[model samples]
Target: MTMLILFELPQVMMMMMRMGMLMMMTTTMMMRRMLLLLLLLLLSLLLLIMSQ
Candidate 1:
């Protein structure tokens, strides 16, 4: 029973770590996309100003 518990502990920890990593990666990707969109908007505004 002790050995089974020990074996299961690492698997559970690894699974948790993997889940955390996936969440972090997806959040970072979403932030990057948002930043890109903001940059595009700023550039368009700048162009509009220059044209005027």
Candidate 2:
């Protein structure tokens, strides 16, 4: 019904927005961690190559 939808729409929209923000935050954090890990690995590889 229109009344039920009207009442529920704002709450549903808020929930979706919150979820989207959380997902974006988590993915960005994961990406940063992955980049750091890759950088560390690359540095270690360079060090190993230089040591030889």
Candidate 3:
């Protein structure tokens, strides 16, 4: 049992690492989407001002 647990340790660690990386990627994607939205809003505001 101990040997099996020891052998599986690396797999568990890898899974944890993958989960952490996926979380980081999702957060970054959210940030980028927010930034893009802000940019679009700014562009629309500028267009409205120009039309005035």
Candidate 4:
């Protein structure tokens, strides 16, 4: 009912915020990993170019 929803609204909002934060943390972690991989690839490419 409307009343129940209104009472639970704050709890729902808190849950949403928590989920959003978790998602952002995971996204940042992925971004860091991707960046490291890219850096390594670039370094390898540079080394190959230098060797040749």
How many pairs of residues collide in each model? 0, 0, 0, 0
| lDDT of candidate 3 at residue 3, scale 0 to 100 | 100
lDDT of 2: 1.00
Off by over 4 Å in 3: 1-5
Better of 1 and 2 by lDDT: 2
lDDT of every predicted structure (CA atoms): 0.99, 1.00, 1.00, 1.00
Model 3 TM-score, 2 decimals: 0.76
Q: Write the per-residue lDDT of candidate 3 for residues 1-52, one digit (tens) a residue.
A: 9999999999999999999999999999999999999999999999999999
Q: Count clashing residue pairs in model 4.
A: 0
Residue 48 Cα positional deviation in candidate 2, in Å, after optimal superposition:
0.4
TM-score of 4: 0.89
Give the range where candidate 2 is weakest over 10 consecutive residues by summed lDDT.
1-10
Clashing residue pairs for model 2? none
Put down candidate 1 lDDT per residue, 1-52, tens digits, no spaces.
9999999999999999999999999999999999999999999999999999
For candidate 3, the lDDT comes to: 1.00
Candidate 4 lDDT over 1-52, as tens digits, reads 9999999999999999999999999999999999999999999999999999
* The candidate that achieves the highest TM-score relative to the unseen native structure: 2
Where does candidate 4 stray beyond 4 Å? none
In angstroms, give how far residue 38 of model 3 lies from its true place.
0.5
